[model samples]
Target: MSQQSNDEQGGQHRRAILQVAGAAAATGLLGANAASGQTARPGGRDDAPLGARLQGVQHFGVTVQNMDRAFAFYTEVLGGTEVMRDGDFKGAPVHYTLMADQEIVARERRVDPRTIGVPDLKGGAQRLDVRFVQFENVVIELLQYRDAAQPTGSGDSWAEPRDHMSPAYPRSMHICFYVRDDVNFDTFIADLEAECARRGMTQVRANRTVAVHSEQERRAAPRETNTIKIHEGPSNGWSIVYCKGPEGEQLEFVQVLGPVKKTFADAAEARRAATNRG
Candidate 1:
């Protein structure tokens, strides 16, 4: 959504959704032009496919039923800092841009998205609340709309979900984070659950922290010559666990024994400089 909208759709004023995302724009998030609501082309070259042209992810969009609850859990429990927040986006540019959708004939049938509007009696983000929380390397975009669809929970209770769509189902997605070297996976899980209890948030559970094997390592390892133990399989000390976030958000944590290599972005920048010189 364009943070500062210059025009109105019908008669509603547009919110500055993009305005608040200046950091993302400067950092090449999603390869999008935040100010203009368009795609961006990097390197002054079309050397890559549209997807490859992307530099990095800006944030994960999460629609939550309770922004306050979600905010507390992420900040207090998960160590995220609120970077930017805006709560008045209903019927604004953000609504049309981020929430609006168009239909394609090849797709399945559904209620027309255009009909879903602000001031919607049933549920919409009439009271649109948006928050950007910054963790070490990733950002979480937490959103809450006024009248939403069936909420993810029943009420003021905290427990593993009684029922949920299996990850096997299409469109199911999860977020993963790298467990810090100073933190033990098992201890992290223990502390995580304990923290939630103290905060009166939903208790979390992590399944296992098994070693990452050869096959998985090959796919996930960085493809650089200065590489270290990543290719050595379980000997690399890589392990992972799956868990549920405070509000049942799917999460994964991994630990890799490593002398962290230069990030791919840094490597790519060097390559770009070399190419430009040549």
Candidate 2:
């Protein structure tokens, strides 16, 4: 089968896996069926309602500059599969590749930075060279936009590292991932830390949570606490940390206690669910 076909098949498999996993979690049977790879038939004793159940991550969409290079880097270096190619944004002709494994999910695409609200590149003078890689069920978008008229400079294109949003222009944004269990969570963090160390990269701030409050939730007193920092301790119910990926995109890793619900089977499932809910 072609890569696209493989991706399609894998996506379907992932959907079924999420539904089974969700049903399992709702009935207080978390790891039993997933580890065993055997789920109860439609009318079996193991079946349960699928309301607010924990579903595995479906997939993530990322933006990139060169599809070929991005595909090679993710598949070879990051240990992901070049599953398939599809459109990036709605109605846009740009294409992206979906990559996933048992532990993480990601999508890569070549995008124009201006579309994301970058002002310096107005009038088509700035050409953004970018790609994205998501880990642990979270998306990490990588950017390398170049102004054909200017030289490359240093410093985060978005903003300085902080939890609170300031008046300063937004420099970067990141997608956070919440792990299912502590053992798997720590293992994944250690692996990523080791990989960064081996590459001689300076490990940035490794904390349990970002102190800055989310702008979207500022008005709501008692903000929803969904983040944790790993540097504090391992036994804690929540853990949070950040890493810099290729082209310097801020990658955040989070681990929250209790189970999380996987809303939809695939991207299509998610769309359908949204429509139904609406």
Which sections of candidate 2 miss by over 4 Å?
A: 1-125, 132-141, 147-172, 180-182, 203-205, 208-238, 242-249, 256-274
Cα lDDT tens digits, model 2, 41-77, are 7764345445434344444434433334334445454
Q: Pick the candidate with the highest lDDT.
A: 1
Which residue window of length 10 is worst by lDDT in model 1? 152-161
lDDT of each: 0.56, 0.41
User: Given candidate 1, what's the lDDT at residue 242?
Assistant: 66
Q: Which ranges in model 1 have alpha carbons more than 4 Å from their true place?
A: 1-14, 23-43, 46-52, 102-125, 148-163, 208-236, 258-278
**Per-candidate clashes, comma-separated:** 8, 19
Shift in Å, residue 147, candidate 1: 4.0
State the weakest 10-residue window (summed lDDT) of model 2.
88-97
